[model samples]
Target: MLPLALAPLRRLFLGLALLLPAAGCSSGGGSGADDAVEAANAQNAQKIGAADVTEKQEADARFLVKATSNALLEVELGKLAQARATAPAVRAHGAALLQSRLDLLAALRALADAKKLAIPPALGEDEQEAYHEVSAQTGSQLDKHLMALLVKTQNQDEDAFDDMKDDAYDGDIRGLAAKYYQPIKAQLDAAEEAADAAEKLP
Candidate 1:
């Protein structure tokens, strides 16, 4: 039982208690548990975003390595052809190839850096073995082997460039592929012509 004088004060306090939850609802309901859950969800989303970025970087790095390694192999073999070729025509062709590869390599490295990709200086295992095999030969024998190697290598380059031009996600890589496609195709044709002629030589 309440005293008569305190009864009105008690009723006013009860009315205010009823309105407190409604006021909290109007103010967007900042419960501590709700805040904790939201914070946890935001943290998870951030982690997922970071993972996506890392995965993309890794994928771009792999593609850059694949494309650039093959180009580097050709450049190495062209250097060998320059030193070991008996025919002046074949030596000249090797010089042109070396220049083309150097130009493309510079462009690729710059583009890869901008795109967060890492490339290797050494060729992969099988290619390194192929390089060693070519390096063992001398003179006209080297010329024949180098010309055949160039024919096969340039054919591979032509196809890879075409595929990259179609599939590349980066604007610069796509542009580079588009820019180099015709040159690579021309090299393939030249290599084939040289290989055929070399095959006829004694």
Candidate 2:
């Protein structure tokens, strides 16, 4: 199982302005596990709070970089999975997943820029253009898919959620999620590495 290393980082991100709105989403909610995740995340943040503001900001930025990358990676993997989905409904769901990725990347970009985090050179031009192109197309596709999911989940269509969940995980969703998230994480990880090697940036 993937560790919940991202949890405390998620809540420290609550103060990040960019992540505040989405924090309400709780996976496996109403379960003891969900409660534990939240509590654990909160406690982790409090523990890390002993650090000075500058240190906190740096840590927050590092967390943002990793989380944002992971999210985008998941979306890209979803797009690939969508291409293989035999069911139109499932494919549409995949499109929505891709759109979500674009939204996440956009948010992360905004947050990183806001925090003055340095952009990696590789993502300078070509990567950005591809992101824009994919984002535009995927956004349109996701709108259609989400509308369909709404109908399906409402019982207008039988067994939609089950189908979607199955399709989402069919082809190594975990692996793909990790693969896509790596680039962004690597960049942030590099920044952290640099920070560690040098005096803290002003």
Candidate 3:
């Protein structure tokens, strides 16, 4: 019923009206897609952060456990040598070693506590066996045994600290190793000296 010109104008307006709703829908969908992409990225970042934390915690825990065990063994053996050795040099060395181990253990405990880790309450089976074997000896025999054990253990401790100082994943763990490696090396030197002295004994 409309005139020819009006008919074209009405068709054009109807076409524009139809396209407007579709365009609005397309814009909203684009915004939603962007939001989804952002959320996924944030989620992935959170997972990566958690993984990194877990890895560092695991590394730190391993170092703490091993260091604690070593400290405990050294403390026990130092006390034994202090009580049983006939040589004044051996006894003095034991006292000094005991004090050093105690200090190291105290620091390790504080660090472990802050990390929410539980330290082993006693020595391991192998350590206990070693302690008993040393306990069975007396006099020069005990001195020889103790010095040998100290030399071996001090070397191991020095090596462990050296590795951790260089390779630990956690900054704090690396710092701890760096702080103690020199002292451990010094202990190793003392142990070697004690062993030499023990070898000279009749």
Candidate 4:
């Protein structure tokens, strides 16, 4: 009974009319979902805020992490030197260094526990690479490689400890740094001597 254009208009209106009730019926559920999402966002924000650490705390934590890894590397290298080095000077230096590094690591672990900082349980990528490189050599080659690596690493470690001793914001971290700086310096000297000895070897 309707005109063609008017029939299409009627169908369009009927479809909208059908959709309107469905939209209205779903509005409450949509609002509830939005509220749940908002609440979850608020809770996450609160949790993040609660877990946030201060900048100084973060610095101290980072130092502890690096120090732990360095100590582990030194310990492993020291063991390797004792087991694989051909020179008496290298082996004796390794033994002394190993004992000192073990003591340092023990102290560092205690301090890290007190600060609630997490330390990695093994060597970092660069440290592993250095270890593997030194391990690949034999006899005098191993001694040469080990001494060179020790000189480089000990210098780096000494510098780090010196900086931390002078500049650390945390009192405990400063104390640890001060405690180790002299020993680290001594180790660096020993490493240099070992390198010299290795160089003189035939």
Among all candidates shown, the one with the greatest TM-score = 4
Which lDDT tens digits does candidate 1 get at residues 1-202?
6655434433533433333321111112244333322332233233323432334323334456656766788899889878878777778788889999989888877875554334544465556667777778776778888888788778878987887677664555668888999998998887877777667667
Task: Indicate whether candidate 2 or candidate 3 has the larger TM-score.
Answer: 3
lDDT of all the models against the reference? 0.64, 0.39, 0.69, 0.71
C-alpha lDDT of residue 35 in model 1: 34
TM-scores of all predicted structures: 0.68, 0.32, 0.71, 0.72
Candidate 1's C-alpha runs over 4 A off are 1-50, 53-61
Q: Each prediction's Cα RMSD?
A: 23.7, 19.7, 24.5, 23.1
Candidate 3 per-residue lDDT, tens place, 1-202, comes to: 5555334333433433333321111111233333322332233233333432445445555667667767888899899888989887788889999999999999887865543444554565566667788889988889999889888888888988998898775566688899999999988998888888877888
- lDDT by residue (tens digit), candidate 2, 122-165: 22122233334444434335333333322322231122222322
lDDT of model number 3: 0.69
Residue 37 lDDT (model 1): 25
Cα displacement (Å) at residue 172, model 3: 1.0
TM-score of model 1 relative to the true fold?
A: 0.68
TM-score, cand. 2: 0.32
